[model samples]
Target: MDYQLIWVLLIAFAVFAYVTLDGFDLGIGILFPFEKKQENRGKMMNAIAPIWDGNETWLVLGGGGLYATFPEAYSLLMTAFYIPVIVMLLALVFRGVAFEFRFKSRDHTNHWDFAFAAGSIIAAAMQGAMLGAFIEGINIKDGHFIGGAFDWISPFSIFCASAVVVGYALLGAGWLIMKVDGPLQGKLRAIAKPAVIWMAANLAVVSLMTTYLNPAYGDRWFSTPNIYYLAPIPIVTVGLMFWLWHAVKRREKTVFGITLSVFFLSYLGFGITLFPHIVPPVISFRDAASPDNSLSFMLVGAVIFLPVILGYTAYAYYVFRGKIDDAGYH
Candidate 1:
C-alpha cells in the first residue's frame, strides 16, 4: 500500500480541518475589537466557547502526524519557519489565556479582551505569512533549510497575512450571523458584502502571483486540457463568493455554509498546486516519509483514535447545537 500517500492525505485532512474549525473562532477574536459592547463581545466569545479549545485538536494531529510520518519534511519546514511558527504558538497560547480570563474578570475584562483580539490577529497573520512563504518555496540543499530567519517576510507574505485577516473576519461575521439576531446580526450582515469583496480581491491577487511566480503551477491550471478541467474552480469560487454576499444581504442563514465552501475550494486549489510534494518544490512525500513499519504502527493507532476524536467533536457540537442564549461561559 502507498502508506506515504495515505499519510500525506491524512496530514492534509488534519491541517484543513484545523484551518476551517479554528479559523472562525480565531476570526471571532479578530472581529472582537470591532464590537464595542461588552455584551456583544461576550456573545461572540460564547458562540465559540464550547468548541474553541477542541478545535485545536486538529492542529495537534496535523503537526504531530507530520513529525511522525514525515520527519524530514517536518524538520526542514519547522526550521525554515521557526520564528513565525514560534510567534504563532505564543499568540495562540496568549489567546487561550485571554479566553479563560476574560469572562472571569469583571473590572479588568477589557484588558483580557484586548489580549484575545491581539493574539488572534497576530496568530492569524503569522499563519498566513507562513503559508505564503511555504508557497513561495523553501530553500533546501542537502536536505536542510538553507534560508534566512526572515525569509518568510515578504510583500507576498504580508499580502497573504492581510487576506487571511479579512477572510477570517468574514468567517467570524458569517458565524455570528447564524448565532445572533437583532442589531448585532444586522451589523454582521452589513459587513459581509465588503468582506466578500476584499476576499475576492485577495484571492485574485494571490492566484495571479502564485501562477506567475511558478511556471509549473501556471501550466497545471492553464495548459490546454488542464484548463478545461480546472476552469470551474475559479468560476465556482467567484459564484460562491457572490452567493455569500447576496445571502448575507438577504439575511439568509446559509452564509456560514457558503463561506466554508469558499474556504474549502481555496484549500483544494492549494493542495492541487503542491501535490506530491510535502516539502514544496523540493522533496516528494515518498522521499520524506518514514519507514513502512513505523507508518503501519501509526496507522493502527490512527484508525482507532481518529474516530474517537471525530466522535467527541461531533457530539460536542451536537450538544451545544443552538443559538447561545447568554454569553456567560458557565
Candidate 2:
C-alpha cells in the first residue's frame, strides 16, 4: 500500500478518536445549564472530570499528524479557518480554567459554571462550522485562500453547528447513564431520548442537504456497487438509533454502550463515503498528501507513540472506574 494512503488512514483514525472521546465532554458542558439542580450539574461534571483532558490528546495527535503527513492540507485549512481556530482555542482555555476553578471557589461557582457552559458551546459550534466549511470547500485561487474570514458562518455552517451540539448532548447523556446512578442517571436517561431524536433529525437534514448541494453524493449513494455495500451502514445506523431509544426508555444499563456503537457506525459510514477526498471535489488524498519521505517519518513515529497514548488512556480510565461520589476530586 502507498505511504500516503497509510498516513491518511492514521489521520482519519485520529480524527475519529478525537470526535468520539472529547465530543461527549463538550456535550456535557453544553447540557450543564439544563440540569435543574446544582447537584445534577455537579454529577455531570464529575462523570467526565477524570478522563476529559486525556480525551483531548487525540485532537492534538490529529492536528499534528496532519501537519506532519499532509502539510499542504494543514496550511490551507489553517489559513482558511484561522478565525474559528482561534475561537476554538480560546473556548478551550476558558473551559479548562472554569473546570478547575469551579470546584475551588464556592462563591464563584455559578460564574465558572457559566463560563464552562459558554466555552463548550462556542468550541463545539466553531468545530462544526469549520467542518461544514471544509466540506463546502475553501475558495482557493493560485493556492491561496480567496474567501473572507467569515466565509464559515453561512446557513449550512450554522445548521452543522447546532446539529453538533445536539449530537454531543446525546453522547454526554449516554455517558452519564453509564457512569452515574440514582436520580442523576434517571434524569440523564430522560434527556437521552430527546437528544437521540434531535441527533437523528439533524443527521437526516444534513444528509438531504449534502445530497442536494452536491449531486455527486446523491449519485454516489444511488449508484450500484457503492449502494449495495453502503446500504447496511445507514440501515444499521437507524436500527441502532431505535435500539438506543428503546434502551433509554427502559433505563437499560447498556444504553451508553449502544450509543457509542451508534456513533462508531455513523463515523464508519462517513469514512467510507468520504475516503480519498479530504476536502471533496477540489482536493484529493494524493493531491493533499506530503512527500513519501515525510509520510514514512510520521508513520514511524506514530507506530511508536500511538500505542503509548492508547495504553495510558486505557489505564487512566481503568483506574478511575466506578461511580463518582460526593467525596469530590482526589
Candidate 3:
C-alpha cells in the first residue's frame, strides 16, 4: 500500500526475473565442459543464444531501480561490495564476448568456450557471495562501510557459492532436457538427477545456517501468524522439487518449466521474508527510499518503458521458439 513498499516489491521482482531467466544460460556455461563433446556444447549454446542477452535487462532494471529509489542502500551496498561487483562486471563482459565470438571464430572456439565457462562460474560465485554477505548483514557505522572488502568470504559465503553452482547446473540440465532430445536428452537427464539432489541438500544447509545465524529469521519462520501463512510456500516448493525429480527421471519435456517454477517460488519466499527491509536492521524501506517526488517521476517512465521491454522480450523468445538444430547456427 505504501509507495516505498511498492518500490521494494518492484526491485525484488526485477531481481528474481533476472535470476530465473538468465540463470539457465549461466548454468549452461558452468556445465559446458562436463559434456566432453563439441557437438553437445554447441547444442547447449544454441539453446540459450537467442534470449540470454535479453534476459539481462532485468538486472539493469533491478540495479537502476535501486539507485533511483533507494540511493542510500545503493551507495552503501556498492561501497561495501566494490571488489565483488567489479569481478561480476568483468565476468559478465567475458561471458558476453565469449558467447558471440565462439560462434564467429571457429579456430578460437575452444578458447572462447574456456572464457565462457570461467566467466559464468566466476559471475555466479560472486553473486552468491554477495547474497550471502547481504543476508549476514554488513558492518556499517554512521552510514559508512567500516569493514574490509574481503569480509564477504566466510564459510557461509563459500557454501552459498557452491549452492549457486549446483543451482545453475540444475537449470542448465533442465534447459538441455527441454531443448535437445535423443542421446543428449538422456545425458542431460542423467546429469539432472544428481544435480537436483545436490541442490536440495545445499538448500537444506543454507536454510539451517540462515536460521542458526539469525535467530530473528527463526521467529519469522516459526512464530504465530507469519508461520501459518508462509508455511505453504516452502511446502509447495518441496512438492515442486519432488515433481521436478519425477519429471527428470521420466525425461519429460516439461522438466525445464517445472524446475524454473520451483526456482521462482523459492525466490518468492525469500523476497517475502525480506520485505520492507532493504538492508535488514540497518535500513527500512521508508528510510532507504529517495524523496517522494523522485519516486513519482521514476514511476511515470517505468509505466511506459517496462511494458515495451517485456513485450519485445516475449516476441524475441516466440520468434526463436523450438529446438536448436545444426542448421540454425551461422
Candidate 4:
C-alpha cells in the first residue's frame, strides 16, 4: 500500500473521530442553557465529564499526524487558518477552566457555565469557518498561503457554523436521552427534533453552496460516473435525517447510534466529494505530501500507536457508561 495514502486516510479517520466524539460534548455545552433546572444542568455536565478530555486526544493525533507526515500541507493550512485556530484554542482554554471551576465555585457556577457554553460556541464556529473556507478554497501564491486574514470570514462560513451548532445539539440531545431519564430527557427530545430539522436544512445549504459556488467540488460530486457512484450517499443521508427525528421523538436510547451514523455518512460523503485533494481543487494529497521517507517513518509509529489510542478510548467510554443522576465529577 502507498504509505502516503495510508497516512492520508488515517488522518482523515482521526479527524472524523474527533468531530464525532468532541461534537457531542460541544453539543451538550450548546444545549446547556435550554435545561433550566440546576440539577438537570449538573447532570448534563456530569454525563460528559469523564471522557470529554479523552475525546479531544483525537485532535492532537490528527494534527500531529498531519504535521509529521505532510509538513507542507500543515504549513500552508496553518498559514491560512492561524487566526481562527488560535481563537479556537483560546476558547478551549476557557472551556477547560470552566469545566474545573464550575465544580469548585458554587456562587459563581453560572458564570463558569456561561464561559463553557461561550467557549464551545466559539470553538465550534471556528471549526465550521475553517471547514467552509477550506471547501471554498484557500488562496495560494506559488505553493504558499496568500489569503488575507479575513479570507475565512464569510456568510457561508457563518451558516456552516450555525449548522454545526445545531448538529452538535442533536448529538447532545441523543446522549442525554440515553444517559438521563424523566422530564429532562423529554425536554431534550423536544430540543432534538427541531435541532435535526435545522441541521438538515443547513447541511442542505452547505451542500448546495459547495456544489454551486465552488464548481470544482460540484464537478467532482455531480459529474457523470462520480454521480452514479456517490448518489447513495445523499439518499442515505436524507433517510438518516428522518430516522434521527423519529428516533428522537420516540425517545429511543439508541438514537445516539443513529445520530452518529448520520455524521459518519456525511463524513464519508465529504471525503468522496473531495477525494484526491488534501486542501482542495489545486492541492492534491500527492502535491502536499511530505517526502516518502518522512511518511514511511511516521507510518510505522502510527500503526503501533493508533490501536493503543482506540483501545484506551473504548475503555474510557465503557467505564463511564450509565445514567447521569446528578452533576459532579465522575
TM-score (all chains, Cα) for each model: 0.98, 0.95, 0.96, 0.97
Error of 4 at 165 (Å): 1.1
Query: For each candidate, C-alpha RMSD in Å?
Result: 1.4, 1.7, 1.6, 1.4
Return the clash pairs for model 3, or none. Answer: none
lDDT of 2 by residue, 1-330 (tens): 599888888888899888888988998998887786777778778888889999999989999988888877888889889999999989989999999998899998899999999999999999889877776668887766788988888898889888888888788877777677788777777778888888888877876677666667677777888789788878888898888888887664577678778778767766665666776657777988888887787778889999999999999878877776566433
lDDT of each: 0.90, 0.82, 0.84, 0.86
Best by lDDT: 1
Clashes of 3: 0
Model 2, runs deviating above 4 Å: 328-330
Ranking by lDDT: 1, 4, 3, 2
Q: How accurate is candidate 1 locally (lDDT)?
A: 0.90
Instruction: Name the regions of candidate 3 deviating beyond 4 angstroms.
Output: none
Summarize candidate 1's per-residue lDDT along 1-330 as a digit string, tens digits. Answer: 888888899999999999889999999999887789988888989989889999999999999999999999999999999999999999999999999999788889999999999999999999999989989899999998898999999999999999999988888888888888788888888778888999999999998899976798899899999899988999999999888878988664698899899999999999888887888897989999999999989999999999999999999988876776564433
- Backbone clash pairs for candidate 1 read none
What is the number of backbone collisions in each predicted candidate, taken in the order shown? Answer: 0, 0, 0, 1
